[model samples]
Target chain A: MKNLRLKAARASLDLSQQALADAVGVSRQTINAIEKGDYNPTIRLCVSICKVLGRSLDELFWEDD
Target chain B: MDWLVRISGVVALVCIGVMVYLIVKMSPDGFRKEQYDERQTLERLKAARAGFYAMLIVALIYLIVTSFAPELGNQSRVWMCVMLFFGIGTFCLYAIFSDAFFSLRQKPWLYLLLIGVNLLTQGFNLVNYFADGGTLRDSVGTNYILVLGMILLLLIIGAALVIKMILDRTERD
Candidate 1:
């Protein structure tokens, strides 16, 4: 769910999923669906999301009980 | 007087039941039209939310009124008239709020049918009033508010449909 929100904030910054995907090299839908919570990204995606969001992996993804 | 309120309550209950049944049977997500734009989808979500809240408000109002005036309507004649008012109010509230809040990609066909059934119900009550020796309490007259309300109600439905059709056609390219 946290990753799902990253793309929305990026979009609000006027960054298209395609552009962000290109910067991070993932599918546009990977960005779109993740932003909508329809899909979950990989560890690589988690790193990219943190990089793009200007945060760390620990801040973005936490283990659930 | 209590009977009148009870009957209206029953009819309202029936309509709510039918609406719930259709809602279950017809998935709200199954809109077949191609999504050409994001606005159409957002509109539908808004309208549906409005309809839901309006219904809840109507139910709460009825519960409070009946709790207070349980004896105000016991006769069939009185209940019929009261329900006529209640039905029209609920129908209009659903249609207008939905229209104002959401631009449906496609207007739910059930809404159009509800409008027709509601109008017909009022018309039937009008005839019933005349046939029953015509008591003022028994008459459900069509007033300017109801006419105006129904017009705005249908107008919004029509507008939503037309916009959807146009958007769908444009998206075909």
Candidate 2:
């Protein structure tokens, strides 16, 4: 359940977890947790992250069957 | 001597309070209250619950022990110190491992320095106590045990934080 899509998107943009977390106003650990699938972020956070990474929710957060 | 002990205890308490206040004031959050993200907050809540349960269990054991030996009731302060420190240690260890103990703006090194100073102070107090031929049941018995417990708890939490940091460094995002 790791969010490799989110990780890839973050890497494509050259954003470290700390940078992404700063952009989203959260701790780096939170970003790490999200990428590791250890935490489920709220939709609001999802939107924020999507906006930051220039990605759609479906692209970064959606799980494939 | 008892009065001197009481004064020293008050002074130590005041110093600790001032140090905590200064730390909060110096925090980047500026005393508005340290901010934690949703996940950290959730983890902290769980840690708090764990600490509460730990304290409850400790208190139950203390009660049972005191009931069996009514004379131990006179050392209620020491038992209370144990219970409080045990709960605090539980909370600290849980939060440290969960990465929820420090706010985003907090400096762990600052806390580590503070703990070191407190530990040194407590160690000195303990040395002085023993030097004065003090027993665990003396007039300042509670103070002695309280200082000892605080030192032990600080050492544990400090060690946990150090270990967590080392582990975190090896973890890739």
Per-residue lDDT for B91-152 in model 1, tens only? 44443432332232334456567756766776566567668865343234334334434544
- Write candidate 1's Cα lDDT for A1-65 as tens digits: 54544644575667776677667755443455566565555676678777876766665566456
At residue A1, what lDDT does model 2 achieve? 77
**B1-173 per-residue lDDT for model 2 (tens digits):** 99999999999999999999999899886668788988899999999999999999999998898899988877777878888998999999999999899998888999999999999989999999989998776357667888888889999998998999899998866
Q: Please report, in order, the local distance difference test score of every candidate based on alpha carbons.
A: 0.54, 0.90
Name model 2 segments beyond 4 Å from true: B1-30
Chain B TM-score, all predictions listed = 0.33, 0.78
lDDT for B3 (candidate 1): 100
